[model samples]
Target: MPMEKTEKTLLSKKELLEIFVNHRVDSPFPGDWESVFKGLGYEFWALRELEPTDSFKNIDWKAKARTGKFFVRDFLAESYFNVMILYDVSRSVQFGRKELLQAHIAVSLAYSAIASNDGCGLILFADDIVKYIPPRMGRTHFMEILDAIVHAEPVRCGGTSLGPALTKLLNEVPESLTFILSDFLYPLDFGYTFHHAAQGSTKHEVKALQVLEECEIALPPGTKGILPLYDYESGRTVSLDLTKWQAFNDTMSRQREGTRTLLGRAGIDLLTVSPADDFGRKINSFMRRPPSTY
Candidate 1:
């Protein structure tokens, strides 16, 4: 169920497991998710940790950890991967291009992670993490997660509040093999919270990757006259004069620079991708050579 409409389930653990597993085995990924990944890489999955509920009484929502070995014949290499994905459910993610890419890139990457035998899970966050799914092996777990992610719903409307979200991840995420997927609008204290979380427990293992949209950063010329933009969730609209494109461009540049600077100071492994860009290649290129793994 989407966070916007988290549904109440009415099934037993055995029933849920049976259905989840059968779905995976029958629906083997359409793409050869394993081929793209090279050598051994850590896969990160953000999981929800919650009490047993009616819908999924059998579903285990904890940050469980595991290690596995795999060998790629073509690469003539064997390595280990610990991978997880942390996604922001903030209203900011509800915006333009960046939002679409999140659905495409993040979801695809998670599949690759599972194929690599790397533990993968999901992190659903707003002002705070709503749930944590512990990373584990098996096709059933992976497919179930992929389904949930593909169906994530919008939460409450609020200006990209990530401090609480990061805090939740900090408290629960098992390791650094985690890959953060967000626009990272860069709010105050949010950076500090993320930095502290990165420094806490397993330091330097967590990596921050930014997903952005092209239009937000730059605009085409002749997009003249007055324009208005509205928040997807809040429905708040702001008017802008087309003649100010140049100024808007300049200001956006400054914002980008500032975001990069702050992220650098925080020592976060930073990556920004646009929706127009080749979503898969960008992520594969960076992860093809992870700095380290557990």
Candidate 2:
């Protein structure tokens, strides 16, 4: 049965902001906060003796209590991170009504980063880039990001080229951390793109959020139907023969594996989310997971 869309099923921007803030503050992060920041290229400096006029918040109470010495924590000058959200607005993303969830995830991440004082940017694309918002900080900039996602529409082209968009990103924001949200149904060679982005002077951190439907994996038992299967982008349609469904299933499996292999080889983190899952909790855990060398 197809899931029914509801007001409660989709979150408002206010709710999304609340969830992200709560997760960052109340939920347990996979590792220490300092470690998480460091993994994202944040710099940390050593602690020094506390000055008499230093704020109490900066003083080390334990060190002061242990000895007669007052200690204060010091840190390197922190710069706002360039967080770019690369969303694939291709027609395939609408499958199983997953577009709302995708949008929610994208907005949630962008909001969370902006709340952390990071400059957030957005790129919505299909065959070509539809919209590009350069990274910036402030409430007005964050609201523009929300508006961009809410008003986005996919292009009617028959193909998607992630390479070109990624190329543009490197040229524009070389030291960015890019989050790519897509179904990755394109036939183009993205492995090469991933390889290039992960290497050289303009190296940027890439993470993938794959949106998929359950029907793509398995059909219900005793299912009897002849459905018109269509590739929204390519405009290719075929009759799905229930008796020969294994062929279709095999193809989807291969595509999933191929996407995973390409990202894994490039040391990119990939997280798959389905509409049926608890999206907020699932995404929070993913964002909070301990970073690996991969």
Candidate 3:
């Protein structure tokens, strides 16, 4: 039997959505949310919330006894922080104008979060911070987030610069459950940014949900022509020999692999999402990976 890898068959949005709705992650992450998130694999997520007492922060309301030492309390029977998703609306992610798909995934995350009684929000970025939706736990709130994403205009000013945005978003989410949905194909120093977020984190568990496309992972078998590629950021156009398609493919593969490795090292959960299959199933599967031992 052949491996059932998800392939991009000739299916319209409606057709693929039908398959997704019929199968895939069963949650209140909204109908379209599941489909979009499946394309990015940011469907289900939970976080260990740190309350005022459990956060190891020293607070002396009375200011008496001169006890100025931080204390680390136990769970104290507190509630868990649900989910929040940060979609990558950056330029590099717009390859073939697919960032629109990522936008849909962001909405799905919001719906899922609200459905789970968790707070959901958005962090849209391109080169710099574009928008930030504060996490709120409510069905209606999730709907608003979805509406915002759906009606968003494309950021014609393209290119991805993840480091700055990651740093800012980490601050916003604090220690909440953050799922970064992005292609992250930028030539920036994201390692330091992620490292800082991890080391300086005081409130949330962050996960890296990488959205990948089939065409990006492997190129079609065509080589032997002039290929002109334009940089969305610099507006610089460069022409390359199509004969080097094999090398180009290899480079892309390496870049993606390297990103996963770097994210893993930063204590971030890495889930691969594809644009070629039932996004809901893929998202549900990825979120539920490495079965819990508890």
Candidate 4:
């Protein structure tokens, strides 16, 4: 069923803190968050036969003495990296309880990254970049991010300018694990832009969280006759025939599948979610699972 429009308001500090606490309790992420996310760092990788070029400093003396063969301990490079969150504040996202859900997801991710001792940054965008915060760590930085999410408002005009935002991220932001949260209702060459972002000198580990309303996916089960559907981004209303709801669902499904395919080809992950989903669990699973598993 189509949900009633929700009131737009700022989330109080108490509410935000409650959400964070709930997420912490529900999340499956371990205390050593870095262990789950493998990357270059001081973390021990493995032991392998030592080669002529291998540094003697890394030699495993015990292993060599036991096996009577030269072996060296391999360590992963520094795994510390920033987590950049690109949030869409376009008008379309304000539909139903989407913005609220988005807030939860964003806040949870920010807190998780910070808890993992990683720097977290944010970029809020509508037709263009509305605000940008460089990645930083510490409790104070987390508060700043929480404050931004709490006060975030959807832009009253213009469509999503995802392309422009990606360009800015590529040009300015350092390589990081980037998550783009949006409804993805706008028409843009997602393949080209995402592929570009996932490759080259500024390559980043990009992922997407597509937040959508149930009604946007399909009309109510008993829907009938013509309905006036409003385009929030454009501030226009168009009549939609309820009889063609099946067709509408098919079209929306195809669009979503197309997006998923495009992003997957670029080695990026995409997770579609609704306002009622368990965001903390979903996020934990998404982070832990491989892209192919999606």
> Highest lDDT, which number?
4
Residue 143 error for model 3, in Å? 2.3
Structural similarity to truth (TM-score) of each candidate: 0.67, 0.71, 0.65, 0.72
Per-residue CA lDDT of candidate 1, range 239-262, in tens? 988788888888877887777666
Better of 1 and 3 by TM-score: 1
**Global lDDT scores for all candidate models:** 0.57, 0.67, 0.57, 0.71
- Evaluated at residue 93, the lDDT of candidate 3 is 65
Model 3 bad stretches (over 4 Å): 1-80, 156-159, 188-203, 222-224, 290-294
- By the lDDT metric, which is better: model 1 or model 2? 2
lDDT: worst 10-residue window of model 4? 1-10
Clashing pairs in 3: 29-112, 33-108, 38-279, 91-159, 175-203, 175-204, 176-204, 224-242, 224-243
| Candidate 4 stretches greater than 4 Å from native | 1-14, 17-78, 189-198, 220-222, 292-294
TM-score of 3: 0.65
Ranking by TM-score: 4, 2, 1, 3
lDDT tens digits by residue: candidate 3, 151-212: 55546555666666667756676556677777777654565433434456364456676777
How many clashes in candidate 4? 5
Instruction: Give the best candidate by TM-score.
Output: 4
* Candidate 4 lDDT by residue in tens digits, 191-239: 4443554466765778888888877766656677988878888889999
